[model samples]
Target chain A: MGARRETILETIQQYVDLVATGSSADVVALYADGATVEDPVGSEVRTTREQIAEFYGALDGLEQSARLLHTRIAGNEAAFAFELVTKAGEQTYTLAPIDVMTFDDDGRILSMRAFWSGEDMLVS
Target chain B: MGARRETILETIQQYVDLVATGSSADVVALYADGATVEDPVGSEVRTTREQIAEFYGALDGLEQSARLLHTRIAGNEAAFAFELVTKAGEQTYTLAPIDVMTFDDDGRILSMRAFWSGEDMLVS
Candidate 1:
């Protein structure tokens, strides 16, 4: 009954798609102005748009595909697990991160925390 | 350098197993003295031993089975997806709730927040 869950779910899917195929700005657009992003949980949190954009910019020219595995949405927060396979020259890496996010009334992400560490990554 | 992820993982598995086969006291033992539990994100949070015991009392004397599906552990926090199947006489209810939790240094659960609503439940 907070933010529309349908809209939030749609936004999550859009986020995953953007992370896979869209630019850094496209991915950052899903977040509100003061939103914070902490990728891999224990890492330093990125607060500024430039920092967040740079974090996502790492995927700009990478060959990657993302697939959402499980999602649980309640109230104004959602935790979803997605698998990302990325190719860097001759190496392929796969990482599945479960992201917890809080959304604003308009379905813009307020904060995003990813639950995964380097040990969870698989290189092939 | 907080709580060991392996220990926390084992504790989570123990929790799911106890919720399926043990009593309320068994489940409550996993929590710290001032732990908080919010079974569903929007619901009221339960604190104190008596209140927490009362919350888990609902699972008592019911035919149930639980299986953990996905887990992501980072630092002293973990987010896991689990499947719970309960049978009330001729009716069967299945719910898959993704639970996010933080653990203390001793691996005791400090806070447990489940992300699932009645809409996510299935009856057969």
Candidate 2:
């Protein structure tokens, strides 16, 4: 891979790692000031930095772990498929989603859209 | 890769190949009867088979080609990133989109959602 692509992948991996480790602050720091996030593909978009931070912060309570399954990089965009396992209360849930994220020249995330549905999740 | 993952990838690759070769009918054949398609992430969803066929039919005119960049499969879902090059009139355009597709047990496509925007395209 080229250096630029390597950098983009590293940024995405860092985001995934932070999320897995429950570092909400660091996750929010990876985005650009006016970056937008739309989780679950069809939901309302979160535009402001504060809103984006809030979205990430919501994951704080859940015992979550993520495994990167695939990564594709082209230009300043990277799309990854990951499996997320979360333990909430006495239940454990698994979700597999494909998140397409675009980065700015400075490597900050510009937009994040996750494609997944209720049908994509499993509970145990 | 497991046998099931291999099958899913083959199905996705065949769909891409049909699109690249301008075989709209064959592309439509890959989907189930009530499949849906939402191109460009957020658009009017095409639900009926006729509408889905018509959507693929629209791609027949342009000299189009696609290259699969990445593929990920988990359960009955697969998401892939690909580069689409199209020659329209005297101009050539390139679009890179990540499309998340879900399939039924019979290997027929259930839904296709493409994640891309004007910012993700290039023209020459």
Candidate 3:
């Protein structure tokens, strides 16, 4: 991989690490001012920074964790597939999602879209 | 990886190979009867086998090729990121896309969604 591609992958890995660690603020900080996020593909896009932060914040109470399975980077875009597990009450839920992200020149995310459907979620 | 996961990856690799070889019929055969395809994320979803076949057929003239970059499989779902290059006239275009596919119990594809934007395309 080229240095630029390596850098983009590193940035994405950092974002994933923040998500796994429940660092909502750090996750939000990775986005550009006008960045947009659309989780689950067909959802409404969150445009403002505050909205984006709130979106990540919602996961803070879930005791969420993630494991990266694969990653690919090209230009300023990177996509990865990972498993996300969250504990809520007495139940645990698992989801496998593929997240595609585009970064600005400064390595801040311009957009993030996660592809997964309700059927892909497992609860135990 | 389990045997099932390996099989799923093999199926996906076959699908990618067909796309690279311009085997539209083979590509369509990989899908279930009512399989859907949504290319480029927010685009209209193509339902019905004929619609999906026509969609793949549209790429037959492009002299397209694909190089897989990363793949992840969980349950009956698999997602991969790859570079797609096509030659048209005197120009060559390259695009990096992440495709998420769901398979039924029989291993036929139930849906395929490609995540890519116009900005991800490069022409030379």
Candidate 4:
């Protein structure tokens, strides 16, 4: 269980690192095959490893950062609440981001579901 | 376990109903003693039952609504993902709200922690 917790932490750290460094490939590599991401309104976009990489690369200068508020783990899954903010040119924006992650027995992320404000992002 | 799940669901439904009906005292009655509510930045405000009632009264017609996206239960606990929106006259707001609930053996809410954006509310 300790190892599982550590792996979950490492997975989150790696995701953050990829965001900070603008490494789309590295970020996509963290997801398990057949993973699906959902927006706060329940719409989801499912993708494979390569598609996730392309999705990340499609954005330009997407500098995003988040402060994790809490993480609760139960068995092979974890739920995280975070305050996410982004910057593009002269505009700054903020949103509430919650990530639900499911890890396989080996501790790799088997699924990742993200919840965020799409309307806020669109208007911002 | 099924009874437990039903009780948990009803708790959440009652919360939503309180918000829509603007019944501050009704909402406060749902919390257990020593309940804590945390913002996305991790700052928490702990209040007793009467204090929670007063807190609700402090707001003027605070109309809020939420759509449950998904709910996952583990034993006596549950985690819910919801899309929360609020309307104050001419203004509209949306948030990604995640609720973590711990229930006592009696099926009453022992604790509830809410995650939302403080900055967005301030700015809006």
Q: Summarize candidate 4's per-residue lDDT along A46-109 as a digit string, tens digits.
A: 5566656666675436777756665555456667755567778888777655577777666677
Docking class of 3: incorrect
What is candidate 3's lDDT per residue for B1-124, written digit by digit as tens? Answer: 2236657777888888888885789899988888899886657899988888888888886688888876656567667887888998999999878888888777788898786666668999
For candidate 1, what's the RMSD? 1.0
Which ranking of candidates, highest DockQ first? 1, 3, 2, 4
Off by over 4 Å in 4: A1-3, A119-124, B1-124
**For residues A1-124, could you state the per-residue lDDT of candidate 3 as single tens digits?**
2236556777788887789784789889888888999886657889998889889888776688888876656556667888888898999999877888888877788999886666678999
Give the number of the best model, judged by lDDT: 1
Q: lDDT by residue for model 2 over B26-111, one digit each (tens)?
A: 99999988899988554789999888888888888678888897665656777787878999888999987778888877788889
Off by over 4 Å in 1: none
Evaluated against the true structure, the overall lDDT of model 2 is: 0.80
Query: What C-alpha lDDT do the candidate models reach, one value each?
Result: 0.92, 0.80, 0.79, 0.61
Residue B78, candidate 4: how far off, in angstroms? 12
Docking class of 1: high
In candidate 3, chain A reaches a TM of 0.91
Where does candidate 3 stray beyond 4 Å? Answer: A1-14, A17-97, A100-124, B1-3
Worst 10 residues of 4 chain A by lDDT: A115-124
The candidate scoring highest on DockQ is: 1
| Interface RMSD per candidate | 0.9, 6.9, 6.8, 10.8
